[model samples]
Target: MKKAVGIDLGGTYIKAGLVDENGKIIKKQQFPTLAEKNDREIVLTQIEKSIEFAFEDNIEGIGVGTPGVVDDEGIVYEAPNLPCWDKINLKKIFEEKFKKKVVVENDVNTIAWGEYLFGAGKGSKTMICITLGTGLGGGIVKDGKLLRGGKYSAVEIGHIPIDYKGPKCKCGNIGCIERFVGRDYIVERAIKGIREGKKTKIYELVNGDLDKITPKTISDAYNLGDEFAESIWIDVGICLGAMFSGLVNLLNPDTIIIGGGISQAGKILFDTIEKTIKERAMKILSRDLKVVPAGLGIDAGIVSAGALIFQE
Candidate 1:
């Protein structure tokens, strides 16, 4: 029944929860991040407020999952959509404020570790977990430990280039896997298809308002037997699978876990990725590989933040 406070820091909202050793949330709450204030102190106070909402006496520690590059000392760097977020020692600040041990890590990395311990990847020795949302984010659990770069949490899997000469990514990379399958990119594909005179239920789903289209729209269209929407999801799966093939060859992980909103496309995306990886990756390396959705569901962020502290 050991418990800890978990904080999931995002651009617009902060989610906090009390999680026990079994990865079950005992209590949880949410608060606005107020990052638009463009003041570091304001955002910091928001995080503190979230912690206070979830903290209790004699907890093991507080774990915060944040969006950024986290260094070994729990210092965050280059965090987007936050004011003056460069090189802030969140661990030190939280520890000082609460007199408890603090663990800070990149949000996706926290999710990866959480899955390794309590989710779909519970028994896997090595796992690759990716969240496909507004952007792509990923983390790796290798050899029963969270993989880290030399100093920072370097697993920025979204930025990994799938095509060196393809479309430019927001990160200034050419043909990043995310550039192909990220939320905006996926929506862009649908728009492009519609403009090219491809008839799809996507247009009907949004009443011909292309700007109103989203990945969910496409998913709904696909559910209604729209071939165009199906093709879009398949293409995205291929893009992701192509990138994962290289990773499979290099890391030989046993499981690849896909999460986030877009992953709800269900069987089509997962099956395509699995098929593409099997055909493209080394047969021996991929023969036992499994592509599965994340197990943590809606409260993944909160539970995974707590898992960071519970991880051995």
Candidate 2:
């Protein structure tokens, strides 16, 4: 079988894997991004070293999934987390450095493709995959093709405007989905609820350290039957469902795959999202829609990036 190399580049870590045609990762490794020690050449060198460690004679191609808005032409327009990345042709850099066919895409898009081909959305003709992490992001695959808009920002569900008078996002948009569902906002909501005397275990769990509070704190508290925690997830699900209703109505995908950190909320989170979808979306549009968790977990990025080469 053919083989390829996949790289998932993020702000804190750079991961690389050797993958076979069947989506099995034969080898994988990760390294610190050293972003604080940032230098374009140094960062590229680290990535090169990882790729080289994974390379072998049979490796035919390479694929990368990065944390930014990547054009179809493999240029990173902007990566919010990576302060130095802007209009860089990463594909060219990797290809020239490695002398292999290299392809690069937005990280979320790669995750969606990974799930569609090998994880939750497999066998579906059309699918939408959303990742709820520090930010909200998504991608859509329709009739076996990934959707890339003219600006390579198609299906970027994070910026979908839901409220007119809501808080402004760093992206300069009012009421973007990320403003409501992002990690910072989720924690912010929990903190707000606690300050207002809503009953929850988050404060105690964090040992009175608000800065240490995280999404996991909220999830753990919810599992412990905390009212405030439960409310937060419920509200998140409702907002997500409301935002997704418009997509379902327009795209009519067969399934929706959700990934990233917040997906771990399990039933408390998914049940509400499912219920809201049923309530908000049109009957026919949502009747058979499957709201499923991503099956690959952390490996989704590596596998999907490899898929770019594996499929070719």
Q: Give the winner by TM-score.
A: 1
Q: lDDT per model, in order?
A: 0.94, 0.87
lDDT of 2 by residue, 1-312 (tens): 888899988898899999887889999999777766657677778788889878886788998988888886789877877777788899889888888999898899988888877889889998999999999999998888888889675667999999989999888989998999999999999888878887679988998888888999999988888888889999999999999888989988899999999888888788888899889889999999989999887788889998878553
Checking candidate 2 for backbone clashes, the offending pairs are none
* lDDT for model 2: 0.87
Query: Model 2: which ten-residue window has the lowest total lDDT?
Result: 33-42
Q: Clashing residue pairs, candidate 1?
A: none
- For candidate 1, report its TM-score: 0.98
The true-versus-predicted C-alpha distance at residue 272 of model 2, in Å, is 0.8
Report residue 74 deviation for candidate 2 (angstroms).
1.0
